[model samples]
Target: MALMITDECINCDVCEPECPNDAISMGAEIYVIDPGKCTECVGHFDEPQCIQVCPVECIPKNPEHLESPEQLMQKYHALVTAKNDA
Candidate 1:
């Protein structure tokens, strides 16, 4: 599943640099995760790097965008293939 930043985000920006897929970006006033690009770090790390660096624990599982690990891996593979094709 992809992670999401809640309203509690302090815009600390710590999580932005930690995202392995460059999936996190700053919104007008908070950080947001791109669900299309998010693989929960399956392609890059054991855990979500953004979650690890978030100071306020604002990042959490996106209930509205849940996916199994296999699905996440599939998405990760697709991203790799797309990049390679590019």
Candidate 2:
């Protein structure tokens, strides 16, 4: 599943740089995760780097954007290919 940042995010700015997919960005209030670009770091890391560095522990699975591990891997591959093409 893709991850989301809750309102509890302190805006510490740590999570943004940690996201390899560039999914995390500053929203109107807090950091927001773009589900389209989020693959839970499956292609880059063993775990989600944003969640690892978030001090408030506010990042959680996005229920509305749930995907299986295999699906996530597919998304990861697509992202990589798109990035390479650019």
Provide the TM-score for each candidate, comma-separated: 0.93, 0.98
lDDT of 2 at 17: 93
Model 1, stretches more than 4 Å misplaced? Answer: none
**Could you say which candidate leads in lDDT?**
2
Error of 1 at 81 (Å): 1.3
Report the backbone clash tally of model 1.
0
Clashes of each: 0, 0
The lowest-lDDT stretch of 10 consecutive residues in candidate 1 is 13-22
The residue-by-residue lDDT of candidate 2 on 8-85, one tens digit each, is: 999999999989999999999999999999999998999999989988999999999989999999999999999999
Q: Which candidate is the best by TM-score?
A: 2
- Candidate 2 wrong stretches, greater than 4 Å: none
Residues 1-86 of candidate 1: C-alpha lDDT, one tens digit per residue: 78888999998878888877788998888889999899999979988888888789988899999899999999999999988898
Using alpha carbons, what is the TM-score of model 2? 0.98
- In model 1, the clashing pairs are none
